[model samples]
Target: MGMEYEKIHACSNDCLLYQNECEDLDECSVCHESWWKKVRLYGPMYLMWMYLFERYVKILKAYFKNRNRPEGCVMESYIAKEAVEFCSEYLSNAEAIGLQNKVDSDGATVIDFRKIGYKNDPFILATQVKQVFYTTDPNDLELSLVVLMKSRDIRDGEGDADDCNCIPSVSRGLTPVDEVDVFDDDDSNLVRLDVEWTYGTRSGGVNRDGIDYYNNLINELLSNGLEPFVTLFHWDLPQALQDTYGGFLSPKIVDDFKDYAELCYREFGDRVKHWIPINEPHIFTTRGYEYGSFAPGRCSPWLSPDCNGGDSATEPYLVGHNQLLVHAAAVQVYKTKYQNTQKGQIGIALNVPWVVPLSQSIADQEASNRALVFTYDWFMEPLKSGSYPAEMTTYVGERLPKFSEEQSSMLKGSFDFIGLNYYSASYAANGTCKRINPRASTDSCVVHLSERNGTTIGPKAASDWLYIYPKGIEDLLLYTRDKFNNPVVYITENGVDELNNGQLSLNDNIRVNYYADHLSFVQRAIRKGANVRGYFAWSLLDNFEWADGYTVRFGIVYVDYKDGLRRYLKDSAKWFKQFLL
Candidate 1:
């Protein structure tokens, strides 16, 4: 098709279609033949995939060379095994687990009768294989059968002399069994090839096993009657991307993030109905680029001496601009390509700390509104009306980047939903700073406080910045509903942390109370028609806390970091379990 071109010309008067028999006409031959034929290009039907295989090999080689062995072991032994087992168990319990009246290529009825179990203490899976008709929509039926039969034979030591060497040996190179001579009379020599029995076990090995882990998680959740709300990028930017182009600081990040988001939609969007493209852009831009407390730290020397070098006043705004652009790009891709087919809703998580007036004075009230404008409206205004907040333009002036008409048009209503991360609330008072330079923290002309005078708004959490204010969530929800025309919302992150004191008792009563109190407010907001849909506890387990360096625990399940990272369910976990029930 690339070699084919239509040497054709159309009449200037639009009298004829230049195609087929008219392709070779010299000029507008029908209309006095005044012009010569021009070339009409045709798109090639098939480009090529031969070159892609070589690049695919290179990708696999690089992936395995840098793969973490411990993580791989957990994935294969636990996550993958559990996924396969869940499918087997689910199908077994289903009323009808087949193609019903459909037949295989051989024109035969297919039936799934496979059983899977674990033999070893930690779980070495064994699957039972059975004969079945093949189908285009091959679920786990065939694979389970093969795995089960192979595992049974291996366990029973029933392989032929030469076939014994074909058994799978995980974590170790294949060791051939005793050699059998096949040169005897009426003997045929059979060569056994050792293989790894795992997902993506073929010639090109598994890269990005996290996909498998998440797939299993989604499958398990569905099997247990639950829906998954997946967040694609949660402030974990790749270090390599950061080194290559300073991560979110450059416009180049827009396409990269879009590609990543599209890949997530392609892979997991089938099961995940709610997609959050990026979580908490405000935190990522301010903390990582402005405060210089996070990875690839960059900030002005005046703000933090730990920073290598950066313009705090400029870089934060630049990063924030690029993040919004990237997010809008991802949302555009999802809406244009994936939303209809995948039937999924996409949104971005914005961490907004509800701002309250320090005093009943007009200045304090205005300051509180400015604080919200600088934080929430910084992103929401662009999303809602295709423009930045008027307050931001007036305060930041030239420090903030201006979006062109095209960019603003792309950003407007680029979400099917909105994810809000509300943890605590702060009182905002008119700023008194007369500093020469102002960054994001002070650009709003407001100061945030957890308390006024000697009285605090609410009890403080383990985190120094957090002060419990459950009513703030209800207020934020109601305000969002009214201001944003009642868009669907999810409380993506809302929880308190506790100190990890290395104690035997996992009695996190504070966390339990915190959840109960906050949930009561959420219920009130729901009653008032806030359009709130779902809520997520801040964390599932104790893990890294970025700059805090795991000094505090925010998980309902306690993790013993000193003891092989063992996990134990705290009282909060038990309480949460019952609450969910």
Candidate 2:
């Protein structure tokens, strides 16, 4: 169905519903629903896409020719048709009542939803992995090896291991490493450590002390057959670079990023097999530049008053262009300098929501395709075809940045694999583009909605923007396979969130269902021959969420903010343990 039919406004009490009638009402006529609820930012009209017709209703009460006989109006005809259809459906389903009566018994019947239910394991047996490494001595480049022993570690301090003892023996500061034999206990548990190279700590590039720290960390991880998937830059750019020339806005960032990547390759490439040069470039650029909700916040004055000064139309594309260039340069450095010698693979992580066409109409189908072009193909096209999508170039025109032949060549096949972060889906419809005001977000000329026909696309999450749609993961994977030549794809990030409610128990049943359903879709995609390799949940712990702060928790392991940051394995974590077994 077309998204036009989905434009519905209902009173808080569900007493009165409005469709094409009284769309501009400040309050519901019946219950007077809260104005804030009706004017929510996530409403269909204010979404990322541009639409020709506003989704809001334009009431023309004067058009009623027969005010007394309102049933004679054209709008009333559709309501009458719906009533007749409901009656017919009731009559047709009457035969099913016999089956229901037969199925219903006098004895109490148990409805077992345990397979999909969220129930924590009575015993907390799941392992929660944490990073631990030796302290770095600035003077000495060599790392002293040590192993800390902790059976059932429970602490927020320096040396805390999981269920098994694969802990780092050195203290936080410049404490000396206490050598402990860690090879004593080797069991069936798989051990792996995730290490991140320091991008820059507010100052310039990583100093000698930070370099030494990472060197020690990698050495420790490798010593115990624990391989590391090192992420070079996790949206943590040095403040110096940002201050120097607007960081990703200028072309100057490419070389500096290359230098950083080369340094990472030279230092830890031997142990770090998988290198993600940049994590979620789309989020970094769009959120940071266009929306100004993130660090280095910059956006048009109309978009946000908090922004210092930025053109939402131009800066986001510029930032994205620079990110691709920087990523290409980093990959080139790795390929030329370290790939053969270090035996490592490098890729960039990109986040794109699955876009579903709001209607079967050609306009909406085209709009859906354009939405993907602006989001997923915005990066993937450059990486694969050495150019941006034609749809983007056509719609955005000169506003969309371009890559030179050399830059395009470098970007093409720069990655060893594709890292995709999929979470939710939205309905895309043809949007009306206004020449007066254009933006990177609205450049695609499409409108997005999380619901259709007054029914949500999926259940809502704690995050207002996030709607749970597990089928989106499968559809996205298949789309990537068909469109992007079926490259090796790793689900780099996928998870849902919930509000941090202190009144509720630590057991997170919703998260368990989220994982179960999403994983099932991933499995289906794999069965359909999507070259999917790995899947990493968005987070292991409920750490800081970027724009939302600590308001929402996406962690499989819930972190108690009030309780000394103590971690409790949520139902999802226990479910994962049992699932993996």
Candidate 3:
């Protein structure tokens, strides 16, 4: 048929493609094979293989009317087919020979080409398709058909199905694919639940709906043999509180946060033996108050004109100070009123990138230590020693908030454990003091760099800020042991992300390797007596990641956002299952 094509030679064992430099090679480099074999190339099959074109050729061959003039007959038939397809658009009851009518009586069309006789029937309606399944087990007999009919009913109901909770029913069908139990498969006994969503105004009363939902969720988790670790605040301050007193910027937030924490303790503390009063307070303080990139956005006008009017130099310090006070207050209430009766352990989740020196110079080494003092030790020192780091006190000066003697004692040893989120590391070098309009970020007098001398600390992840430095986990744990009096620690949030490029494959081996490497380091840290107690992956499901939104996926379980929000376990999740086993 005069079709253009190119013939490429490849190894019989599929070691490598014979192209470019290897075009003239007679045998495979690795296997030394002489004959052609199945080609293993990257990307979509349509672009790299002949199978699709071969199928099209078969279709074209069927258009031939005469053997003597096969090509001419195909050309004539193809033109007539195209003309009929164009004219069919104007005819109400007519359709092209190969095209089925999309519209049916109920405005829905279902096509079934599996039946032998109906394969070529262009106008097969919804009634013609039988709900069929082949299963040896009696329970699996009607599973797929029932789900299909239920989905159709949901679609037909439109807005009516919005209120229908189908998870319990639909999840039954998923058991055959992956019979995962929280305690059995993942070996996850401790589960973290964010309680910030339940915070409401004192005048308007507690959020009953949120409380009820959590009560059910908590009960269900416990029934599944899982313990709940409740977090009171995860940078989700109530809008009412933020509007009333500028949120964490004002000291007024301390009592309000304390009240909210107490409420949670009263309601759920009995069942929730593990409590985390705040998750990543430093991130909340800097991102929300100084950078103005997060909720209740506020920063120095000079830093960002779009800020909601804030003092970067003072507000970040104030916010951080108040958050510390808030955390202390919550811990005090829990330890005083709830701890004795509930028998619970409380902590705060703090995240910090492990800081390394840019070079071996003393200045860079000291800067790296100073950066840690400013970041990790900023909160840790206060909790352990009842005061901020000396580096922070000297550099930030009057801008840094001081705790009164009474508050200082309350701040000391506030937690039974520390929940640490370590993802990436950065190289720090000594930086010049910003004499003019210095903000909290620059107050450390340390320049943070991902790379030095054109070499990165580690491989980059989908999130530009996240670099894979698995050793950082071990180093950070050891540092925590040495600097913070070896407090019991839980590695709370640690995972990497990949771009959501709509790839269909669930072979997430990179994520598997990431988890394996990081977990191995965690084990090493534990072996070295770092007092690390537990480890939890950052996420279980692909979710709405703040700032980045849905552009990146950090979950081991892949969520098909395009396909009814269905979930499939990636290779990493399977690896985790086996690892835990």
Candidate 4:
């Protein structure tokens, strides 16, 4: 395996077969010395016809299988046979394998990819992969297993494959629990810990135990050598406070969040550094306010309900004003009090969806632009430049509150990075700015992102409201980079949905493809100078999918709602772990 130097790119199973194209692309030195030493591996004419059939037949089968499964789950089914064996050989360990079986006559073997490695393991995850990939017959069953093994990582929920070097994801929205420990140097090893500044424990009450729970979770994660991420606020917004003051719409939240964040940082800052102050504020606010879907359930527009200036109700802009104040105040508090002690990155997360027009007409473009402004620019303006977007005034008029110069400066330049969450896209066409009729209030049709023909676009998925759109992710990222002068970005959330055990394998392969395509595009954006850093696949476990309310499963680890037993580790999770390693 020395002296024949040619560029090779084979890793898990992408073998870069080299050839001297100027003379003999056919005469591979390695192939000539194989089992059929006297015969050439291929004749010149056979190479073209062979790729069409021999090389891609399994790939085609996997495609049809993938189409019918969770989404990409179908496509991932067919992998290059060499790739399969490559994986089998790399992770060849058997400390915890629970199931191994031959799957039907075609000879596909389903091995538990997660259980391939123990504390001590080989590099060939499948029992055959060596230091570098070398040629084997395309029909090799072991290679096929490698393909399936990697695909399983991302196909559904977390599995035994959870032990990869990829960016790690931890539990979201934690609740406090009683802890027991053994008195030893490894005391931290006995606990499973995580931090949540504002999580609802039982009856949606603030678990006043964010600090203790997170401390243990962080210590345990550190003991396990896992890099922990602490999201300061997810929509859990201390139910007690929401009942006390009106939540984000009330400026009082600024003080409340400061105290809460202070406690979390004080407890877990050493082990937990990356902080997300709020997860998808746009989704939380719009879903709750305009749609009356989430917590606080306030449907009235942000300004006074009286456009005539009579009946006093909070208007949209006024509420936005409070959101800005709270966000800025919290950031200011973090910077003033904790920045010196804990030198970790902190930022806000945004839920970005693609907005496209049906046509090239100026009106149509304007419609699409307007939808984006209402949905994203509402928060983007304050985050990027510390002021509301100029367009808000046209949409909300007096309802869009004007922040004083002092407030604008306070909100400006406050983030270290941006966490982007994406799912789908919408078609926009001209529409009334704000609807006042009750009929309009009853329907969940988001006027902000709509099509004129009344036919909403984008491929349909588990959520009736979201149309699966891969390009939306690309557009949103490029757009964000252009708007914010290249802030660091991570795809904090991006997932597809599916039902388990109905007709399909609860395996979410489509979600896997969705991630690959979107991430591939994200990689391209990075090549083009977008400071995108990492990606966190939405949920680590299939738990309650808010609003949709547990109907849709997005975790890499499938949760058995009964007795809370989690059994399935998704294909996507497995694949992602490989990419990380």
Number of the top-ranking candidate, with TM-score as the measure: 3
Instruction: List ranges where model 3 is wrong by over 4 Å.
Output: 1-188, 197-204
Model 2 C-alpha lDDT per residue in residues 330-411, reported as the tens digit of each score: 9998998889988877887889899888889999999999999889999899999999999989888988888899998999
Error of 4 at 538 (Å): 1.7
Candidate 4 regions off by >4 Å? 1-194, 197-210, 300-316, 434-457, 500-504
Question: Model 2, stretches more than 4 Å misplaced?
Answer: 1-206, 223-225
lDDT of 4 by residue, 1-581 (tens): 22233433222332223332213443333322222221121111111101112332444344232233311100010111222222233222212222222232334222222332213321111100001111233322112111111211233324231231110121111121111111111111111122333321211222333233345445554554344445665554544455456666677777766666665666566665667777677766555555444444445444323221211223334445676677677677778888778887777778877888877888878777767776677787887787777766554555566778887888898788777878888776565433553221222223444333666565566776677777787788788888878788766667777754423244566766666666656655654666665555555455444444345666654555443132355665455444333
Off by over 4 Å in 1: 1-213, 433-435
- Distance (Å) between predicted and true CA of 141, model 4? 60
Ranking by lDDT: 3, 2, 1, 4
* Error of model 1, residue 8, in angstroms: 72
Better of 3 and 4 by TM-score: 3
- In model 1, which range of ten residues has the least summed lDDT? 177-186
CA RMSD of each candidate after superposition: 23.7, 25.0, 26.9, 24.5
lDDT of 1 at 185: 8
Ten residues in sequence with the least summed lDDT for candidate 2: 72-81
lDDT of 1 by residue, 1-581 (tens): 12243334445442322123243665322222221111111011111111112323554345342333211221122322322343235322323212123233445322111111112211111111110111111112112112221212222233332221112221111111111100000111111011111222211223244355456646655554445555555554543355557777799878766766766677677877777777788887887678876545678998877675788888989988998898899899988998898888888889988988999999999999998988888988899998889998988889899999999999999898888888898999998754686788888889889898987888898788889898999989998998888898877678888765657567777777777777767766766887765566665456445444345777765666455345566676555444422
Model 3, span 1-581: residue lDDT tens: 11221344344442333223243776323222221111111000111111112223554344334323421100001111121222122221222123222322344322112321223421111000000111112221112112222121222222232221212232222111110112122223555666543222222245454455457657766765556667777665644456556778788888767777887888888898988888898898898788877656678899988777898999888988998999999999999999999999999999989999998999999999999888899998999989999999999999998999999999999999998888999999999999899998999899999998998999999898998998999999999999888898888788888997778556777777777677667656765777766667765666545555456787766766566445566676555554443
Best by lDDT: 3
Better of 3 and 4 by lDDT: 3
